[model samples]
Target: MATVYLDYNAGAPLRPEVAAAIAAAWAAPGNPSAVHGPGRAARARIEAARAEVAALVGADPAGLIFTSGGTEANAALLAGLAVPRLLLSAIEHPSLAVAAAARGGEEIAVGPDGVIDLADLDRRLAADPRPALVSVMLANNETGVIQPVAEAARLVHARGGWLHCDAAQAAGRIPVALDALAADFLTLSAHKMGGPPGIGALVLADPSRQLASLLLGGGQESGRRAGTENLPGIVGFGAASALVGDDLAPDGPTFRVGALRDRLEKLALARVPTARVIGAGAPRLGNTSCLALPGLAGATQVMALDLAGIAVSSGPACASGRQRSSRVLAAMGLPDTVAGSAIRVSLGWASTDQDVDRFVAAWGELAGRKGFTVSAPQAA
Candidate 1:
């Protein structure tokens, strides 16, 4: 059997267009900051790619700052915004969580469906009468549950607080309009959207808002982030961003992936009566499913599926190689046992019916060995 990769949320396979763009960028020479023919060419490439990435989220190109990855982008925003306090959703990615923690952040609870409790958020802001930054993810990377960012934004702005959204998982998988979301700062990762892993961006909804520079040399990224840009990665990011239009379209690849995801969930649930689909009641990304199988450890399922040529993840790929219960699920009020048994299967732009079929088959076989026989659903 061919290998089926269902770990798109971790890092999607690079698209051919993005690969070609990286190769083209590698062939070119010169620093983007240098004043010369080659340097001017490099600068142009970076700017063009920046525009493409900015367009993906309906952001102004002028406010986009390139960072090493989503981690750095999140850190930069948390630090640069210089908010004395931070209020973050409990289910934020580790990067945001760490950054927020460093700033003495307070955790806002999410409902059992994995959505932030807006009333709790409002209450938190009211309790803390300081100028705080509210950081909530556009979608939970683990459960794929979409957050009510626009509503959160209104709450934050009304309290004279800044709202920063981590849109890494939501950008290519759903409609992520930065202005429409009313986010003061937004973070994105290229790898999450089929681009190179080392590059990402922080988009400012209002370019006039001053963000302090984290790095202090060469004055790159409009003096917000220092260090020479990753030209090849940025070029690949632009290429990937250009391809996201189809994924965001109403009748697009994302919808097809969503159908496959739904099929997989339906079959899994029908086969294993004890299994639970996390975040099923909430609005979610089209291409994601978080499956929690009682009496089965997530790590064991991941390993078994891997042996069967199916690649799935117990949680965020970043948290891979470690044995730990999913904090995202725990935040949603799941018991430790259920959280520990949860695994995430995410589809993407290149996912197909065959890929979904293979995964379902492998999963069913594995479940059967554990004394649960999962029968495939009849084709409609």
Candidate 2:
């Protein structure tokens, strides 16, 4: 049977334009840092890609630092911060959580709606007079709930602190701007935005700000990050970023996907009256839905969907692609069963009405089943 892919948040499929761009970039035979003729050509291509990627987030091209992916961008930025206190939201991605924890970061509370509690943030910020760096993801990968980064930014700025937003899940799905959000640091992932994987970027609001190097012995990324850049991956990222403009308009691809997500949750709720939509109370990206049933384990749900030829994630597919219960739902004060049973169905650019219909049919059947035989989920 043919499979319907619904796990865009895990990693969107590579776009055709990006693939073509990568092919063209791969044929170029010089390093971006060399001083020769081919090197100048390579450097020009890299600069062009930088401008394209910067345009997507309304950032200065000089402020962007390309990395291996979003994980590295978050890690490098957090690692370099020399703050007296570091505050993290309860719902941060592992990259931010882990890196901030290494520097003695404290967790701030979030409401049951899966949004950051500005009061808790205020308390944390006020509790410490020293400068603090705050980490809040723009949109969550698992629940798709959007966070109040801009409001947090204002508060942090008032307290003479800086805010870092991991826009990995927000960037090509919803609108993001460095100035509009007033974030000191913002990160983006290529694969999450229909580009090639293994490449991403971090943007600084002020290009002249001194950033500590993630790597030493080279001047790449103006010495903030040192390594030979992934030329083709960067090219593909630029190509994908160029495609996002048409999708962000008033009634564009994102709006349609949001409708499909609503339809999905509606059908799931009608078919299984006990079903719960995690993070439904908050503003979320249009492409994602987190649904939970009372009795089923999320792994069981993922396997059932896999058997039915529908692809979804039990939670955010971690680095290992393992089916894991959601920390995001637990952070929202959900019951253990609700958190354990939640699965993420994320639509994207290629999603259609038929895809939603088939998913609802498959999901209803699985939820209605008397028993389940276990297997691995194909998080493809």
Clashes of each: 0, 0
lDDT on C-alpha atoms for all candidate structures = 0.89, 0.87
Segments of candidate 1 deviating more than 4 angstroms = 376-380
For each candidate, C-alpha RMSD in Å? 1.3, 3.8
Instruction: Evaluate model 2: give its lDDT.
Output: 0.87
Candidate 2 RMSD to the real structure: 3.8
lDDT of 2 by residue, 103-219 (tens): 678999989999999999999899889988898999999899999899999999999999999999999988999989999999999999899999999899899988788788888
Candidate 2 vs. true structure, TM-score? 0.95
Where model 2 places Cα greater than 4 Å from the true spot, the runs are 319-324, 371-380
Candidate 1, 32: how far from true, in Å?
Answer: 0.9
Alpha carbon deviation, residue 163, candidate 2 (Å)? 0.6
Task: Give the number of the best model, judged by lDDT.
Answer: 1
